[model samples]
Target chain A: MAAKNGSEAAEEHTSSAEIRSFFDSAPPLKNSLEITDKLKEFLDKNSLSAGDGRANRIVCVTSGGTTVPLEQRCVRYIDNFASGHRGAASTEYFLKAGYVVIFLYRRGTCQPYCRSLPADPFLECFEFIDESHIKVREPHSEAVKMAISDHQNVVEKGQLLKLPFTTIFEYLQMLQMVATSLRGLGPHAMFYLAAAVSDFYVPWKSMAEHKIQSGSGPLDMSLVQVPKMLAVLRKEWAPFAYCISFKLETDKNILLKKADMALSKYKMHVVVANELSTRNEEVVVVTGDEKVSVCRDKTQVGCDVEDPLIKLLVEKHAIHIVDSCS
Target chain B: MAAKNGSEAAEEHTSSAEIRSFFDSAPPLKNSLEITDKLKEFLDKNSLSAGDGRANRIVCVTSGGTTVPLEQRCVRYIDNFASGHRGAASTEYFLKAGYVVIFLYRRGTCQPYCRSLPADPFLECFEFIDESHIKVREPHSEAVKMAISDHQNVVEKGQLLKLPFTTIFEYLQMLQMVATSLRGLGPHAMFYLAAAVSDFYVPWKSMAEHKIQSGSGPLDMSLVQVPKMLAVLRKEWAPFAYCISFKLETDKNILLKKADMALSKYKMHVVVANELSTRNEEVVVVTGDEKVSVCRDKTQVGCDVEDPLIKLLVEKHAIHIVDSCS
Candidate 1:
């Protein structure tokens, strides 16, 4: 990546300082010790020695949207829009391509392999034939079977690690933890950051202790910028890891520009750009020298864009791996 | 219920005007016609007329939290804290008490009869024995069966009608539709208001069209009070319907006080008061002449506060039905 311009370099420096203070002021994670232990265990089991020809490749795939709490006890929150579809679908392909996956996701968003199942309640997918017997309804049985089998395969092989988060604080902290854990893998480690993180937040110290009262006329609140973490992730946290990010826009015109900016600013290997309306059907993969648009096969009955998107990314990741070795 | 005080009365009047303007300026519901039709069909089938003493009591139990969108296309939203547990559990109890229920709930929140089932993905609760065969995991089999059976019973009998909402706009609009449809059921109708609604919102007309841009320094947004819908529900929509609302507070001292205020100002028949910490263990039911504390049966392995809470409400509803006829 070319060196940052003077203004951009200054911005990066400021952001680094802000990131430090943000973490310092933020409330400690509720189960940081347990999370660290889990990450260590996951990596220990998956990371083969350097001389092993068939060493497992590691990819930390972040999915879903993060929440910014409006109160300390959290009766209210500001949420970003994400269903985790891209991450979940891509995880399946990453597993198919023989990568050990660490799936960090928001608690209630979509899950890998289970996308075909009824969105929760999911009561519609089951039926009681007798007083004591329940079974998947006939129409849903095949889909349920496929989802279970797929999930079970990776789970039994211990190739997938799932960690859930809710608030932006938890999400960023956990991401850093995962990144730090995978740092030793160098270029073999990939970070597929698809989570829609909050742009702004109420600093924990300044957040309201109780629910904001309603009877008080109009409500005015100021939210500080959520300190940029991507730069630090690239430069400090896991410097040698292959990084991929996403840029989603409602406007088609600004989508590519934003993706380009993200690629440059974060020093990401690739930035996937998708317009809000057409995201499911297609996405443009933006790298330093190319912008490749990938689309689902419209003629195929069940094929989705993720199928081809992950394939292309897998190829790019191979080149990154080879270049790093040389 | 007693009359409102002077300031309370003035606030109510102002709120009524605000409600009108709020609805007038709000974006039209995307599926208003379909919602109206569903409500009508539900009420028509369930409402058995005046002379039938065995007429099914119709209670509209609303559950979960409502969101206030930050943008017109909605990249961000302010959310209230509720899992819809109260509503879901209470709906099961209401059904047991022979009430035909109209469950207006937030999408993806808790569901009645689903209290036992594993939460979604729920992939953990299923296993594949072979490539084509899947079954509920052994540990979760009984729960899956019970959930399926109980849900099947309700579906077969058509005793419950569920309508889902996400945004405050959709919630209020659909709620109004349900209330209007239940207007003919007078004394037989009940409204159990458990949804944690937003206290404030950005007016639709002024909301940004695209995702709010970051990096422009602190974000300052002004949100107007979400116009109270309770007063209109009680007075105009379903004039003689028996109403039960909830008051949840973090502070124990203010719990009953806020419940009392809500009861008088909204002229509700009962207000269930719960502290944030102890809500599932106990609650205080505040009425015109009573402040009854109901606690869960700790001695019993599976008993909950909702079991007693709903029983008491059912008896009170029976009294309400008899008194209204006299």
Candidate 2:
């Protein structure tokens, strides 16, 4: 199903239908069925089906940066600036709030509960007693133990499901599958879209087949805008799902304006707007009726802004669930 | 110093002098001197200085991919394909061969002795006994324990010093410092150049001051060539260091030819050539005198090709050291 020709046609633009066709023509991931089955099992086991009389809410949290490959056999890519920290941290908070989370993350990005580990944790956190014996050093033992136990508890109880993706194709495909599968849950389903997705892409049909050679004097290529999937997502895939998207800007002047545009154009329930400089310290949550400013508590050392952000989101989701039922 | 203007004049090309001036015009990293001091102490403590009568070889292993930013405060970047797996695995083998290693790596890539860990090791490798108790899962315990112990042994003995970088500027600056420091050691120094560095970059002077706005309509960019630092390293920085570069290609036809070009152009002692499809299973060591194919033993499940690759490089380095001394 892969595109047969490389740069055979120079398409100038992409439409929603064209994007959908691209995905339909592209080869399905090898583990798609397995992941779908697992998601179904998790939701069923958690009693998240509509009218199941269970209060458990289910959320899919996407984290990290998505890559736009320039070639079919990708040797180079354009990447957004993200470490997956926000998504991972938010997942931990969601689980703590008694929500089952499907963590859809870029491979090799930070994992929930493991954020506080040292930069080189495996090397810096251990002490050698002898050549054959090793133990966690005293300075890091407490932190490592807590991280491990907390992560284990969530996984053992089946509260967290992780799915890893590397390229743009894999990310969008997996997201569609997950969102479509959650349509049955209606208002009980939520999506925290924190991943920094690329805005432009090289179409598979026009991409180079091999690694791009640098000997060429100059590279002159045109990239088409990635078809905005937000409209289809909100209107068709999971209409009743509570969707929260993010807007990150370097300029403070245009941040809220962009956020408002997203909320209106995409029909997102909430748009969290943040400037690059102060993102870790504060954010403004934008909805049609209200704009709520959330900030990290200054008194708490090493506190993350995601803690308060998740609390507000959970409350908002609960209200949506009740309103939909009524 | 930071560049004054962003893309005012479009420079069409880059040369070695331009590249050196770029670094000169760029702001110096805050901790460059601190890192140099630490490296000096590491070498002095290991008795690797000339006339110290020690046979300890020192190698600066560059790992992972360097990012080429489009903006001064980068929100997006062009990245080369690399996981740092080869570099990380090779570091362990170098350590096993009794070489002191300075691991200069990309911030979040794989690390030495940690390659065997699962992608989400903190989640997959632990089991919860109770809410407060956790242990390594039985299946992963032996491997985890050994990895931790072995990493700790080298670190405690000061045989491995790791420095992390994220951008092309930081990487090139750190590399220059490391190479210049090792200049005093002459023939005892070695460089394993495995990092997938970008061949094209937007010079800091020409990069956008803020995040590139999407509304600007089809972004037009001109990227200047990244100066070939290998040539500078051989002629000016550390001429006597035995250097081994890597050539990765998707086409088998150009793989050996590119390897040979790098060997002759940069005057490198050896160049490892591998096709992307079969890199894990096989690689050819290309030197001026001979080309030796090194393949992984298919029968061994856990064995990596880096073991034999590093062994061969180490032997070649030893021969180079002797020939230089005589």
Candidate 3:
């Protein structure tokens, strides 16, 4: 049986050669496979699989910010300063340490370093400013007209980024769906709420079915709270996921106090504190226990802080960590 | 004075040689300075202040799914299959266009490509799922669980791809604020409504500030139409900004009828249409005036449809277009 056929040996030789050539060429598809294989190998070499009962080490990370929709006519949205560098870097450390991570990221936040966008939706950029005529004031009319003319020249010559939005309510509805889905994954998970969720949503009253003449009634848009999503998360979904609240304060005492209060109110396991006004690179990680305090070095301005945080989490949990520091 | 200056020059020369030698032997700081200069040069060459307004083109990119929050937990939160790819990719395109793009994103959507989370402020990614281990059971439970679990694992493993959001209300709030800011710029602006903004919002019974516990006397969440925002934009902010709305339909009659309705109601210059089930690279661009109908190459998976859309907008407007095509 061992010496059955020369053809079998020949086929095996050809297969090995093909594999070698494919690896040598390093196609993108092949590269992905190689990376996947490496990860699998790492997971396998050490008992990182859920079957090994290590899957219980789950961490859910929510990064980026939220939008508040006040009305169908006008909305109020603020981009959180979350670059996702901290979350991404930290998660890498968590995975390396054999923990499962669930990332709840806001749209338009950070993506994988190598992830590329699709290539068909030919996008268009434009500036829609219309300056056909300018109102003539008495003394400053000539100067104002000249400035307007000059500005028109620039507008006619340049392109403007066109972004489309219809109503604030529409935007908010979408976030609730994502949050609801996240709430379903059951407990044994940890939520790293790093995204900047907006505080206000606008409400439109008596919105027009057609474009109102430019100068219509005082056209006031009303705003309201973003339906207290954090509160909802605490009450409804908190039981299924470990919650971690963050307080970015310009004042030191307020930061610590808020963190402490959050710990009590939300029953968070860990609370991280830092100064929003200062540009220094130091962070204090506060756990629910109050006794666990860890300080990490300030990351470089453009560097990702995710890795360090992950390291800290892994160290605290005593989980098997991956050695890929990169 | 000449003698004293000559002595001073001699002393300076000695230190200058030391500095030059240090740069030659260890050029990290020097390299950083060089890179900074390059960035400044690029900015100067593209900024309006630098005489070249190539980089001033603005792309108002939106991200994240919409959310509809309820005062109490609801049977339905109003949602869709949007992963926020449309908005996120558009944002990246706007940034690449050398335009000062203001991203009007939703909560719980994917984040923009280049954002930074500081360590000092203690940014954390948390989920409410791991709190008390609430189990999920519903018709949408399996799908929702899978979505959340996948995101959770990726985030926990330190992966870069993460989707953020839970409902549509938050998404709308984010868009409204951005729209107001862009509208303030007055015309010369472009808006792209690629996000799947919901047509309905959750109706609440009351705004009581009390915990809504499970088994609380047959709770109910009502649904109501979300007032059309496109109409509001045209009436309140038109001539300041041109609008584009997306119409995803399963039938051609509905698509055309809705397109016409949107055009007449919102006074939108363009309406992008796609089949409700259409995914991947396939899409249809429908203009309000029938000026042009363009078909693009099949969209590559994971890429963006924004490029073609941006191109069309620029061509039709006869304005300069900025992009990172490569």
Q: After superposition, how far is residue B268 of candidate 2 from its true place, in Å?
A: 1.3
Over the stretch A210-285, how does candidate 2's per-residue lDDT look in tens digits?
Answer: 8877662434455555666777789888999999999999999999999998999889999999999999899999
Better of 2 and 3 by TM-score: 2
lDDT of 3 by residue, B225-321 (tens): 4445565555654445656777665554566666666666667877877655553345566665573444445555434556676667655433422
C-alpha RMSD over true interface residues, each candidate: 9.8, 10.8, 36.3
Candidate that would win on TM-score: 1
Candidate 1's error at A122, in angstroms? 3.1
Ranking by lDDT: 1, 2, 3
How well does candidate 3 score on lDDT at residue A87? Answer: 53
Candidate 3 residue lDDT tens string, A1-326 = 00011122222111334323323322122133443454345334333343223454556565555443222222212223445545545554555566655444554444322111121100101111222211222443333333333223322322110111122333233333333444433343456665555443322332232222112111222222334344445565444455666666555655677678667655665677766544125566787565343444444444434455556655544322221111
TM-score of each: 0.94, 0.91, 0.37
Winning candidate number (lDDT)? 1
- Model 2 - which docking category? acceptable
> Ignoring the other chain, what TM-score does chain B have in each prediction?
0.93, 0.92, 0.57
- C-alpha displacement of B212 in model 3, angstroms? 3.1
Model 2 clash number: 0
